[model samples]
Target: MESTEWHLTSFVNLAVLTFLFLCSQGQVNGDCPADGRTWVPFGQSCYYFVHGNEDRFKSYTIEKAKEMCKDYGLLTVRSAEENSFIVENSLQVWKGGNNNMWLGMYYNSDDDEFKWNDESHVTFKNWEEGDAEDPEMPLIDTCVILHAASGKWENVSCSEQPQHGVVCETPQIRLQRKNASPLLSALVVISVIMILGISAAVWFLQQRKGSGSTLFPSFEYHPPFRAPSADQTCLVEAEEIDETS
Candidate 1:
């Protein structure tokens, strides 16, 4: 029974020690970004596709689409990966047979440059043949659209074209609760280890007391002088009597 308890205690101590070590090392928990309101997670951002007649109006222009996406996130493409993700997931976003949607790209005739709605740098482009140009009327097609059928881009007049849907995107959020300072985490870990150590020490002492065991057993010491036996006493008396005689 004592051996069983000892083994169980050893296992508990080992587990506690392992937990302490892991805590001290500050291992981060595997927490992914949350996808809310049916938004899809791709890479480091969350994407939302607005389509169907449920919340959409009869006609939605680029400016109206931008207003709708304002509450969700900015209406723009951040990278080529994001653009590809949008293309692949286009059908899933809107299944009402519409193949074209508004992107965040717009051409500015003032600077003679195409830029995103958020005014970010345009590092990637996926324009189709003859897109983003007007041979007869230059600077007429300013807004961009993702052509689902061709999986490419085409520029249309922002005010002239009516879109069936819009794609909104924003960066993924990191959980703030898990981001503790290293010193605070270390202090918490050390406190837990100390508490476990103290509890184990007390338990060990209690077990030793109940088992009547000592770390170093001491022996009782006796004097060399001992009381004489009956025979020895009689012999001593007789010798004393003879001497007296």
Candidate 2:
């Protein structure tokens, strides 16, 4: 019965630990700024579209678009889902105008590789057949743009080209609600209290157990030896003399 109870207690503690861990994870999240810009949430990051002319779909060169998103870096599509999302938003934002937009990727003819403007590694990619089939273009033809009709990337010359909007991606951010601090603090304190209380109760119960196992090590106690005082010694000698007489 004791063993069963102990196992049950262990299970309860494990469950509580798991719950608190999950709560902590949920408390911290990927959130963009509360600024006026409409930041669309994509896996672990936020995105904003900047065409500069919201009244009408206007296009900007790579340099101009970069300037427009000067506060934030140019869009770097890391995955297919992110690429698709950007294309969809561009179609909505640009409407009648050409939906082609500038990306952060640029061909590095020296390294014979493509690189993002922010220097992030190129892991996942979605490129059109023309881009992959064609031999590497010259360094001047390094810039990349997302084809609106099809969600694929295309290499284009960095020279004067048709106007295209730019997208901005913010740095990694963690979200915490202004009013949620006190609630989270209370939960943490309560969790700690519960764990300590359970531990103390378990200790007390173990100590109270009348088992052969001792709570503390046992040891023998011996009284210290002492020499007789002068009066006691004299009395002992007198008694001995009377006995001898």
Candidate 3:
């Protein structure tokens, strides 16, 4: 009896463990990717963030890139957590390569301040190397990040144009407009479909009617079988008499 009780307890414990294991696996499956990536949905664009590789290339000036992202309804790379996540995952992306890329920041000479494309103040400075300096031309005041091994922030004189990779920001207007007024659009589509269906039905009925008339003409005046006339009767009687004679 003692041995039987021990076996029953052991079985219960094993079943509990199995249930727990299954529950853990279920939780894992329901969670996000194990690689520490997140999904971003902005405008018509969808972005995935994974950490670790920074050796890709798609160069553009920061402003131009921001405009491009805006056109596609996306934002610039502005999150430290996201950046760190990407770094941790060792994911390669276009804007995080070896070359000095343009961020969504520029030096505004008129205002004598660093301004973001969104007209925000440039408080966050993370430049890399020999940037934002032109001893000969003081008027060439612009902000750019250095791409040296140190990867420090530097202020340098922006020349005519630099073909650098860019981090972009899509404008809010575009995203707000995308897929907006869905109910009305859907209603319009449904109405059009209904109209087309009704028109096709009418056309099909008309065609069927036309084909029926052609295939079987309607005879409105059908003649009936008539009895013989008086002349016909006299002729018949004369023929009968001849035959008898």
TM-score of 1: 0.56
At residue 77, give the lDDT of candidate 3.
38
Model 2 scores worst on lDDT over the 10 consecutive residues at 50-59
Candidate 2 error regions (>4 Å): 2-7, 10-27, 52-56, 96-98, 132-137, 176-245
Give the best candidate by TM-score: 2
RMSD of each: 9.4, 7.4, 23.6
Instruction: Please write out the lDDT profile of model 3 over residues 63-150, one tens digit for every residue.
Output: 5655555533223334444334333332245343455445546667788766666777755455443344445556335645434234
Clashing pairs in 1: none
Candidate 2 local distance difference test against the native: 0.75
The per-model lDDT (C-alpha) reads: 0.68, 0.75, 0.49
Model 1 alpha-carbon drift over 4 Å, by segment:
1-36, 54-59, 96-98, 179-188, 191-245
Tens-digit lDDT string for candidate 2 (1-245): 57546756875786787577657655755678788887888787788876455545566888887887777788888888888888887778667455777888877667677888776678888888768435665654768888777888887778746567678887658766344466776787687678767776776667557465667768899989999999999999999999999
* Models ranked on lDDT: 2, 1, 3
CA shift of 209, model 3, Å: 85
Model 2 TM-score on a 0 to 1 scale:
0.64
Question: Which 10 residues in a row give candidate 1 its minimum summed lDDT?
Answer: 27-36
